[model samples]
Target: MSQVVDDSRGGAGPFSRFEFLVAGRYLRARRKDAFISVIAALTLTGIAIGVATLIVVMSVMNGFRDELLSKILGLNGHFSAYPLEERLTDYKETVGAIEGVPGVRFAVPFVEGQALASGLTESTGVSARGIEFASVQKLDLLYKSAVMGSWDGWDEGNGVAIGSRLANRLGVSAGDIVTLVNPNGTLTPFGRTPQIRSYPVSVVFNLGMVEFDSFYLYMSMQAAQDYFKAYDDVLVEGAEPPDVLATDEEIDAAYQRVYRANAIEIFIDDPDDIATMRTRIQSQVTRPMTMTDWQQRNETFFSALQVERVVMFTILSMIILVAAFNIISSLVMLVKDKGRDIAVLRTMGATRGSIMRIFSMTGTAIGVAGTLIGLGLGLLIAANAETLRAFISNTLGVTLFPPEVFFLSTLPSKVNAGEVGLVVALSLSLSFLATLYPAWRAAQYEPVEALRYE
Candidate 1:
């Protein structure tokens, strides 16, 4: 009895060696208490699954948001300036002034309109953008995305660039001809007549975004202006026709005199500094123009994505909460099954706090182990997310993340350390809290009554 008491006490301390020893014994349960062990295993598995799921889901959501933002903002500038009252006839000077502003990267002038494009296979509606060759070269995203053909003589020839998807849909490639029909065409005595024209596909670009790749086409600034007849009224009123035998410089000067841009698209160094950048640009341009930022244009779409992410996090968190409840139930059953052991330890000079500490250790060990395992599993899965996605997609003969619906061509994952830490903290906190009730119940066990039944 003296040795048993000495062993159980293991010196006068809060969490003595004896407490950990007994907790370990209870964790490695005997055959009679195998059912309790099973519950504990299930509880651990539950916590592990919950943490892993949360990490994977959060990473995917982050990746989705980042990819979409990059693709969208990469194609569209940070903001654009549209004329309020008059045609942007002097857009070149305006662009120069705007580009001189601090934090401004570059400004481009382009004409955008809708047209029906007819290919060999079928006809589809296209968003046509007429941009200068120099400006097109400055658009890093579009310029670098060219997969077929070259932009060598982009402005010299009557050719247009189309997205890779659009080219594929039209069953046309670079060097193939695609016809465009404009509903708002030249004005005639009868009425405004639709204009039909054809141009060879100069370049095929893959923006890696479904919407842009499937619908957008680009032509030269001169071609766009001529096709759209932009600023025709202003030109007809302001400038006279050049002489037939005019010099090259004289003719070029006359062209510039009449040329006008629909809007000036401004790219800034930092897109997040929209308010300050807008103020600076507006002040520098001194033109009566309405400014619009990327954030303003994409507010609704991004807002919906943010809301969906929050809701998904909340829903997935319930899995962890349910696992926490399982921990409580499993510990309660373990404490009940170990009633005789608790009584024996109490009679052998064990304090209530010692008994509580032992059980708390038992439950918390499960939590810590589960959390660590989940952290490893989640990181591994996230790191090889794309590879796994492809493997699974091939095996199942189904697309996991279709580019048409998701806007990205492949599965993407970005694991944020802060978010992973939060998940770990939440899991550990829930696990610790769950142990309190069962530990308290064990601490309250009356040695006399418990032993009398035994």
Candidate 2:
């Protein structure tokens, strides 16, 4: 005890060096309270597992959200502007105006409408989108990801392209003819009847999304506008029939078509600065236009993913919280078991603060050790997430990540520094708090009472 007092007085630091030495010894040495050691080990394991799971889960969530965003943004423009009028006739000038905005990258006129697609075997409803092949190819995603046929021949005015899922449903392929029924047919003295026309399938595209794959159809700029009567020059619903009772095909063919745009598809430099860019774009334009940004377009989807990420983080953090409780239990037993030593140290000149620091250091050491180990393991696992997923799935002969279910071929992970810091900070804070009661209880021991009991 004189040696401890000498060591305490010998050090000029915040606490005696002797305390840290003893704390480490206590942590490593065999204790009569074997169950206490087991509780301590369990506590350490819990903290490690909690931190690891939180990092891995959050990373995967971030990756999944990012992948979805990439696919959506790649297929759809970052921002789209709809005209106040039914169709934007002077879309060439409008595209120039939108492109003049600083952040605006790619601005192109697009025509969108609905048509009933009829194949030889079956029929289905489809969203028809018209794109400028040359300008849109500069966007390049559609051109590059085309599953069958080149991004050519669409400009020939009579060609059409459908998604793979749609192709499968309709039992049609490229070069085959698929009839599109336009409900807004020539309104004659008789009620408006359906106008159907057959067009050769130009290509098949796979957007890697089930909804898009099954329902979207694409065509050339002139072809789509002409088919849907998007332009005013195209025949109005009901003017006159060529014959008193014209067949549907004859009625459909009797139309003069011109280019009319329903919307301008725009790509911006920074998606995060959509509002500033939107304001800038609106300022540049003279017409009353409505702009929908990427976030606004898919608000519900991203919101749901964000909510799920937060909920998962909260639930997984409880693993560490439970470990904190175990830390409290282990420390309490240590304090009780070390009561005689605490009293002897007090008589030998160790202060109450010194006793508290020693026990607190013990608990912190465990927490820090567990946290570091978990952090390392978590990052490693997250980095090689796809690899790990494949290995487990192959070994177990189970589908760990189904492409149809998750919308991805393999698992994804994105380890964020801020999230990792948050987990580490939370773990350390919990560990520190768990040490308080036991450390204080140990520090409060009276030398006389403790010695008498001993």
Q: Which candidate is the best by lDDT?
A: 1
Lowest-scoring 10 consecutive residues by lDDT in candidate 2? Answer: 232-241
Backbone clash pairs in model 1 (N, Cα, C under 3 Å; residues 3+ apart or in different chains), count: 0
The 10-residue segment with the lowest total lDDT in model 1: 231-240
Alpha carbon deviation, residue 48, candidate 2 (Å) = 1.1
Q: Estimate, for each residue in 1-454, the C-alpha lDDT of model 1 and write its tens digit.
A: 7775666557566567777788888889689988988888888898899999999999999998998888888878899889988788888888889889999999999998999999999999999999988998888889999999899987888899999999999999999999999989887999989989999999999988899999999999999988887754322335576799989876665664466788888999998999999888888888799989999999999999999989998999889889889889999998898899889888888888888989999999898888888888999998888999999999999998899889888888999999999999999999999999999999999999899966
Give candidate 2 misplaced runs (Cα > 4 Å).
Answer: 9-16, 29-31, 118-122, 157-159, 167-179, 186-193, 198-201, 234-257, 390-410
Summarize candidate 2's per-residue lDDT along 291-406 as a digit string, tens digits: 88889888998999989988999999999999998898999999889889888889999888888989999998889888988899899999999999999999999999787778
Instruction: Give per-model TM-scores.
Output: 0.91, 0.85
Q: After superposition, how far is residue 427 of candidate 2 from its true place, in Å?
A: 0.6
